[model samples]
Target: MPKLITGGVAVVLCAVIVVHLGLGAAGVGVLDVLSFVAGNGDENTRNVLWGSRIPRTLAGLVVGIALGVSGALIQGATRNPLAAPDTLGVNAGAYFAVAALAFAGVNAGVFGNGGVAFLGGLAAVALVYLLTVGGVLTPGRVLLAGATVSLIGMAGAEFLQILDEHQTRGLFFWGNGSLMQTGLDRPLVVGAVVLAGAALAPLLARSLDLLSLGDETAQAMGVQVNRVRPMALSLAVVLAAAAVTVAGPIGFVGLIAPVAVRLLGIHGHSLLIPLAGLTAATLVLAADAAAQVALPPSAGYGELPVGIVTALIGGPIFIVLARRVITGDADRGAAVVVAQARKSRFVTALVIGCGLLAVAAVVGLRVGDMDISWSDLASVVTGSGQEMANAVVSFRLPRILVAAGAGACLAIAGVAVQSVVRNPLAEPGLMGITGGASAAAMLVILVIPSAPVAVLPVAATAGGVLAMVIIVLIARQLDPTRVVLIGLGMAATTMALVNVMVVGAQMNITAALTWLAGSTYARDLSTLGWLLLPAVVAVMLIVGGRAVNMLALGDDLPRSLGLALGRTRMLVLCGGALLAAGTAAAVGTVGFVGLVAPHLARRIVGTATHRLMPMAAVLGAVLVVVADTVGRSVLAPTEIPVGIVTALLGTPYLVWLLRAK
Candidate 1:
């Protein structure tokens, strides 16, 4: 049976290789390549095969093998079926390191680039290990920590890209895994490193097999468990980082390949590693081939990144894994208890928060590319200002209003979601709704260019609701962290959909990119209209805060209170979805405001949802306004996106929250 599986995968891999080589913009046929090898082909065919097709095909193999073997080793060492480079944040770390280097004007050669990626991946995986160790290393905990780290790393990379458009264009292919290549040097060098890692992987296989039986059993079997696990993970890092250096961070090839191999009843490390590599190569190559078939390069838009196709496929697989994996350990230390209720503190914080928000708006108005004095600002507000001051205020005022409105909506949404999920980490953005909204909005742009302007927010709302419903239905009664893990998978899938639509649009992607990054540039009062629906929803949520408070007391008590448990849960969740989706449609992502603001508010105002909701709204508005001000002032003219700034601010809080005893 093992022989049959290996042979079947090898055959599929070879077929995929052939198809990938044949399918490209140049239209190089197999016959032409064979003719070239026979010394009877034209110069065009020879150049096409040698310069582009062959190199790209080889790159796919190298990247696929690296990810597959790395994943197998990770799963083996940790004895966790869901362990993978992508799931542990290693790929995002590696990608971020490479982007950071390019932005810093470092022309590191191939080996140097690989080394940087290795260090970055090492740091990331080490952080995940530390985070998991703080609590128990459950599958859901590891994945949640990974999701947090990846969010931080990716946001940092995007921030750098926003500061440097030249580097952004240069790293585009690297940001998403692409098989396009200039020559064979990269594939050849990276392939040799991958081969070395694979060669060393078997040395630990015997130990890894024993380690799977638990540390006591492994020690009883005379295995040097500590040394063996670290060494194995180091080798895995080298392999995964090398793959990132060559073709960027490809998602899910690592996860799906090894899992598929194990499911085929081939569990021995020696045979599993090699066969999994073959299986991943087949999957990667086939995905690239499918991308070409779905959207040919000549379709005006450029070629789809092979990562997009793989992510779309991997998303469902991850959801399956998150659902079926034993997650009983997830809720062990995962209670979402807040500070003791303090009425005086809540009132004081609310007054102070509202005051600070007003101050922030005033400060933000005065801190643009050109600052207007206090007297000039007062004049602008009263419509008695100089022409220049009036124009600047006009430009900045609408953006500030939109920012405040969007922030309040996200915070209220967070209160509702956290109340329902009973998880402090349950932000609407993190729950995958924003990704759904962005994808749906992009779909409208791509599919119906002439669609009415009103259709966009409606489509976005429906998409977000559908995404949330899918997550709730699939992960019903599961651990909260497990549900969030599944939601992260859905988020990746939806983002891939957005990337596909953006690539297909072939129009000015600048506006879409800016919006997706959660910027307030060129936004006006017109954009404020999009926030009205969410604002109304926020009011409804705040009015029903007492019912939501009942939800956090676990299932039985809420039912005893005649709260119609299921209906309330769905209604509040859908209401939160409405708030978040509407905000996302109005103002891109603006991440972490939901998570951080509500969390901070709860600390100040306790868990009473009625008091918690309004305080969080005020704090959320203040946070974004401050972020917008800081972003504008940091660089003279290059404004950082508010989302990236908020992410940086919120990442540490998330880490601390998860790691707390």
Candidate 2:
């Protein structure tokens, strides 16, 4: 009964906000809109009502309800409150599909674009699901897989945007999330799709309730877990795709709406589902109103993308919720502790792994643009070849060192973050440290182009630290997984910020492309020196204490061990910030070295203690240097960014890991 009342209030609020907002060139009041609607008003007012305000309102309504319900379904299915259209790559898929079509000169009107977006969204969801395929769907695996796909999709989108300026403008505006009308057909189609999805959603409510009890329990209850899971997912994808097609991928509404409903203590889907829809409606209406009024007029005449505005508000709220989860205030069952047991066989193999890294370093110098034989390498090292000595010393040697150092530093940061957070997936890149650093560095370059090159590292470090601090503070009260969710949120914000910057800069596209792709061997000696200093400092910090061990036991265990949890967390975070920032500042944002290295290390040396820290660091260096070498040699004159290469390699490995475990 209370749920119904709350929903009623939400609906009223949504209606008020929607009706009060003026539309188009001649703004009309609520009474004027109503008078025009009732067939008792001026032709201009009637045209304005039918042509602009009504379509805009309907778009908001349909899109809001779609995102809200879709969010709830995704969150329930994945058992992750952070799961939503944006987080799961549904919006990305839709946006990219439309953008591609636009660039291809496919004048797919709104309805045609909707169809394309729907297919694309379905494909993306299917890919994410397949990547994390296992006996049971785990939240962690789903999130990781979704994240990987989102990154790949976003990268593709950015690349396409660079290739076509007109499409880029269209996507940029669309990506911001708007309720502006292209035509009335869009709202009608979206409305029909949303209604169909809503009807199907209730049918899954029982299964969702059972599923929330987990796969084992649901199976025991004869829930046909497999079939039910896919059905729910299909419904969610349809809703999300429809929403994106109409409103251009508004973010966080779905994530925030269901969470809001859940927090309101409406657990039963019969009640929570409708209320969540209402909450979503209210949120979008409110956000749209704000976007119309609050932003500077010179920014954009139409409206700030409602999606970006939602992110600005919803990101912080999500972070707060995540912190609550991390602190064990929300869900105690979510906290995880890594066991402290070592295996001799794994340790032995890890030593062998280090030897392989040494070989990789040697090979890295020999496989670049100018391939030098081992004899040439030896001659150069021994100062025997005075002829090619300068070439070897100035170019090949520095490149090798850059690759090795960056790989090692990133790997160590990944391992340290995982240890500190007690989550195997807690890498710097995954957690937005690299993205933050990259964004900050880009800002520094844009605003103060004449600043010393050395300042890039400093700016990156500050950005990394700032990002880490935001995540930590927000997740301080949540569980490790929740902290990971907050990191994902930060990653989204950072990526969006980067996109905006790249679009607005009008800089050389090649430079932007190189940076986004994660090049590592572009720096001279001064940058190299800056990178090396931080790499050394990070290594020292990682090797310094038993804090790593205590941290793996989760927050409580560390406190019980008489460790100063706050100080230790700060120290580890600082080390990681320095490492990621310096590396990002030196090279571009290298991909999955940080993520893949620690997992690879754990597989070889076992997760016991920080005993494997050094091994992981060395292995990370090998992975990166080898990837860099492959990136350089594979295309000859045209070098692929090492980051892109790593993604290609690491994404598969991650999927394999998910399936194996």
Candidate 3:
């Protein structure tokens, strides 16, 4: 069965390669290529074949093989079918390394870039290992850690791109995982390395087979468990990094390829590695072919990244895997609850938070390209001021208001979501609302450039709510962990869709990225109006404190207490989704506000829904105001997006959250 499957995959891969080679802007056709092979070809056809088609086809094949083999190795070592370089942050790490390399103006050749990618991938996997080491390495926990690490790596790459836009011109699409190659030199070099790594991989086949039995069993059987695991994982990282170096981190190929092969009931490490590679090569080529078909090169939509296509397909597959393998219970997760604070202490924290937010707003008004002093500020308020200073404050004032309102909405959304997810670490972004909003907004922007500004926020809000609804319906129950996993998958799918539109439309990239990064740039009172509904929802949510608190209780307790658990969960979740999506519509999806602020409030005032709600709002407001201030002030003209700033703050907090007992 395994042999038939492997051979079938090889044959399919050949067909995909042929189709991929034939579909291009050069008007090359499969029949033309076949006739050329039969010795009836022109120079132009031969030039297209040798110059563009062959190199691209070879690059995809090499990358697929590398990712597939790496997936097999990691899954075998970890004994988790969901394990893959993409899930473990290796791909993100390698991608960031290459972006950094470009930013630094380094002209490292093929071999050197591969080495750098290997280091990045190795480091990322090692961090993931360290984070999950204290636990049993369950699929859910490891996957969460990997997702967190990926967020950090992506944030870093975004920061670099913002700082040096010139250096990262084509980096955005490449970062999304394109297979367009300029030449064969890089692919051939990386291919040789992949061949060497694949050969060394089988040397650990015996140890891996035993290790699959369990560490103690493997040790008892005289298979050095410690040494073998590291060797296999390191080899996996090398393979994954090589693929990134060559093809810009095409995701899910490694994951889909190995998982697909494993379903054939083949378990041998030697056979799994090579067979998975063939399957992966086929998946990559096939996805590329599908991309070409969806948006023909001759149609002028530009080449869609093969990675985007794979991500779109892989997301549902991941959701399926999570549903089957993940128990979706919080039995093993650390407590997210906190004891209530003293009334006086809670009051003090709120006061301090308010003060901080005010100070941040003031600083934002005062410290842009020029400073507006107190006198200038007062004069502006009194309708008499320095012309330039008045203009700066006038421009900054509405944005600051929008930032504060959005922040409060996000924080309350976080509080409402955490109440249900029962994990203080949970954020609205994980609910798929933000991603859905961003995706919808991008689609509108690309599909209808003449869309009214008001239409964007409305479309974004509706999209976000719709996304959350899908996640809720798919889970069919309020399983928090499962919901989170499904949300992640949904978010990936939405992001892939957004990338597709971006690649095809070739929109104004800076504006799109800033919005996607959750910027408050150019936002005014009209945008501020978008927050009114969320603010009202926030007030109502806080007022319904008892129900929100009841949600934090376990299922049986909530039911016994006569709380309509299902209805209440839906109510609070929908409200949270509204606040998050509405805020996203207004500010373009500022992240970590919903997370960091609420979590900090919990630490200060505990998890009492009423107290937590207000405290979280204050803190969240302070966070975004400060973020906006810093974004505008830091590089002066070259502003960092508030989302990136908040990510820098929130990533460390997430890492800490994962390590919590």
Candidate 4:
């Protein structure tokens, strides 16, 4: 059976390779490929085959193999079925390192780039390992830590991309995993490293197989469990880094390939390793071939990256698998629990936080290109200020209000989602609500160019709700980790489609990009009005806070306590989605404010949703207002996006949260 399966995969991979090499903008047929190899083809055919098609096909093949083997090794070492480069933060870390190098003008060779990527991936996974409670790795902890790290790394890369868009065009395309190559140079170099990694991988198969028998058992059997696991992981990182260097962090081939191979009943590392590689190569080849036709370069749409196609396909597959992931043991209770505090103290904190937020707002208004003093600001309110002050205040107040309102909405959304999911780490932005809003809004902008600004918030909210519904429906067991993974997949799908839209739009996408980055620059009073929906949603969530509290008490308990688990979850999630959608519409896709504020409020006031919600709203408002202020002031004329600023600020908090006892 194993032999038959391996043979089947190999045959499919070879067929895909041939087809991928033949079909492209140049339209080389199989006959042309054979003829070119026989030295009897036309020069155009030869040029297409040699210059572009062959190299690209080889790149896909090599990267696929590398990613597959890496995924298998990591899964083996971790004893977690969901382990993969992307989910482990390896891909993001590697990509960030390469992007940083490029941004800093390092301009290294292929080997140097691979080395840097390896270091970055290694460091990231090290952090993940260290944060595992008592050094006992669990699937949930690894995934949670990975998601957090990936967010930080991707946010940093986005910041750099935003800082210098023109200089980073090549880097941006590469970051998206373009397989369009002019020559065989990169393919040859990267292919060699991948092949070397693949060769070394089999030697670790015995050690990995033993380690999978659990650390104590393996140790008793005379396996150096600690050394073997680290070595296996190191090799996996090397493989992933090589693939990333060549293909720019293409995702999910590693995940799906190994998982598929395992499901075929081939568990022996010797057979599994090779079969996984063959399967992944087939997937990559097929995705690349489809991409050419999906958005043909010949059609003037430019070739879509193979990575985007793989992500779109892989996302649904991941969601399906997530539905089946065992939920019983994956649960990790709330990360932080604090003693209940006095209501007076909570009230004092809320007042202080709100007051600080107001002061931040005033400070924000007072600064900018043209500064405004307190007296001048007061005069503006009374219609007695200088013309410039009035003009500046008018311009600043709308953006400030939008930021504050969006932040508050998002924070409340976070509180509601975290409670409903019973996961302290839950955030609407991370769970794809914001991404859904952005994608829907982009579609409205592109497809219905006449869409009024007012239509966006409504459209965005609808999209967010739709995405949340899909994610929940896909989740068979409402496991927080599974839901989070499904959400990540949804976000990837929307973002990939959004990327395709941006590429095909053929117009200035500056506004769309700014919004996607969660910026408030040039936002107007109409934006403030969009906050009304979220504000209403916030009120609803606060009113329903008792249900949220009940939800945190596990599934059966809530139902036993006369709380309708399904109905309560649905209501809270809807409210969360509405809030997130409104915020996304108003300020693009600001992240982490929702995540950080709720956690902070929780630590301060305990887990009573009522107290936590209001305090979180205040903190959330303050966070965004301060973030916007810092964003504008940091880069001077070239403003950093508030989304990016929040990410930078929130990442440290996330790390501390992860490490918290």
Candidate 4, residue 590: how far the Cα is off, in Å: 1.1
Would you estimate the TM-scores of all the predictions?
0.97, 0.76, 0.96, 0.95
lDDT of 1 by residue, 1-661 (tens): 8888888888888777777777777877767776776899899998888888899899999999999999999999888777889888899889899888878889998999999999999999988887778466667677788887888788888787678765554455467788888899999999999998888888887888899899999999999888899998889889999989988889999999989998899889989998888888888889988988888876756778899899999998998898887766344424333444444577788999999999999999999778889999999878899999988888998999999998999999988988777777888888898998888888887788799888899989988888889999998873667767788888989998888877666544545556788888788999899999999999999899889999877778889889999999999999999998988888788788999899888778888888989999999999988888888888968788888888888888887777765
- Winner on lDDT (2 vs 3): 3
> Rank by lDDT, descending?
1, 3, 4, 2
Best by lDDT: 1
lDDT of 4 by residue, 1-661 (tens): 8879988988888778878878876777877877776889998997788888888898888889999999999989888877888888898999999889878989798989999999989987887776675633557667778878888778888888878767545655677787777778888998888888888888878877887888898888888987888898999999999888888988888899989988899888988887888898899889888877777777887657778788888877777766666644335544332224434479888889989998999999998766778899999988899999988988889999988888899999998887777666778877888888888887888899997778888889988888888888887456766677778778888787777777667444454556677899988888788999899889988887888898877777888889888988898898999999888988888999888998888777878888999999999999999999998977777788899899999988887777766
Query: Pairing residues by index, what is the TM-score of model 2?
Result: 0.76
Candidate 2, residues 517-631, lDDT tens digits: the string is 6886565555568687667866686566477667656667779878998888778877887788778888878867877887777766676545567777788888888888887
**Predicted candidate 2: what Cα RMSD to the true structure?**
5.6
Question: Model 1 compared with the native: what TM-score?
Answer: 0.97
Candidates 2 and 4: which is better by lDDT? 4
Off by over 4 Å in 4: 133-136, 327-344, 370-382, 507-511
How much lDDT does each candidate structure score? 0.85, 0.74, 0.84, 0.83
Ten contiguous residues minimizing lDDT sum, candidate 3: 332-341
Point out where model 1 deviates above 4 Å.
34-43, 329-344
- List clash counts for every candidate, in order: 0, 11, 0, 0
Clashing pairs in 3: none
